[model samples]
Target: MTQPLPTRDTIVDFIEGIFLRRGAESYLGEAVSMAQHMLQAAACAERDGAPAAMVAAALLHDLGHYTNEMPDDVLMEGTNNYHEEAGANFLARFFPAEVVEPIRQHVATKRYLCAVDPAYFQRLSDASVYTLELQGGPMSGAEVAAFRANPYLEACVRVRHWDDEGKDPERAHPPFSHYRPLLASLVTS
Candidate 1:
């Protein structure tokens, strides 16, 4: 039989365990580990004076990477893992839409940025560039317009920017415990 799901009180710990167990893995060949990347993203959001929910979204934006079943190189092998949707779906169970919507839209924001800002595409890391092709290689005019209509567009872009900056190997980041209380405050259930 399957194990019982974690209750609201225990869900935070369950998430923490995921970090402890898997965060040390490489982040798609980036210089930082997955946990470090996430923590740095949270740090960037927090440093920029973002609201609590946006900071949380940045912290957990790539959570689908952790939760997805595929190998880390799945994107390199030319597959759109759709980790953004998976992460947002998982987070929606416990987080409010304010926190979850941005996570869901973060990937699309990448494509959107590429379409609107040529420099943005130039800034993407090699792995991100590779994944971009699999992610449909930027938005068309109609796609850009539709993305601009999203209520969470600004928040999603903020998270995406943090995601871009979070991969710096030299950046120092706080421990996950630093944000545990923030996570607890945002839990919906």
Candidate 2:
């Protein structure tokens, strides 16, 4: 049998370690840290009246960057680092469906928007564009059709919007530490 995943405290510790070692340089420029970005996004989601679960999902959406080092080629190729997959996989062990599903579906949501919404991709920053190419080029028609069929489309859209707008620290949600108590309770229970 496989070993059990780390406890929630361990996951939190892992997050702290990422904050200390990676800082923000990996995600964007040094001007804004990953932790800061996540918090800002979470805050924005919360302020916009998103449910607590979605706000939490927004805050932790990029958790994969902290847990694993994405290859630069993957970053450049525009292929999904499976960040959504990774983040969802990790969080699902501890968080409820309300939290995990949105994180899992965020990337698909982005693709769906890009495919149908004419102005959607244009708003992405240069870096985002570069990454998008590597993440598998605009969604194919089949992918779009698949996305349209999903029930989680609304949550995914909200999460994607929070994600794109979240890079700005000033406008995103509160710090990750703010969710620590809630995480701890979930893990221990």
Query: Model 1 segments beyond 4 Å from truth?
Result: 1-3, 68-81
lDDT of 2 by residue, 30-59 (tens): 245777777777777877998777777887
Instruction: Identify the candidate with maximal TM-score.
Output: 1
Question: What are the lDDT scores of the predictions, listed in order?
Answer: 0.85, 0.69
C-alpha positional error of residue 24 in candidate 1 after TM-score superposition, expressed in Å: 0.2
- Name the candidate that leads on lDDT: 1
lDDT of each residue in 1-189, candidate 1, tens digit only: 122445679767877877788899999868999999999999999999999999999988888876443233433333344788767776777889999999988878999999999999999999899988988899999999999999998898899999999999999989999999999999995
Model 2 lDDT-worst window of ten: 70-79
Instruction: Look at candidate 1 and give me any clashing residue pairs.
Output: none
TM-score of 2: 0.78
lDDT of model 1, residue 180: 96
Q: Score every model by TM-score.
A: 0.90, 0.78
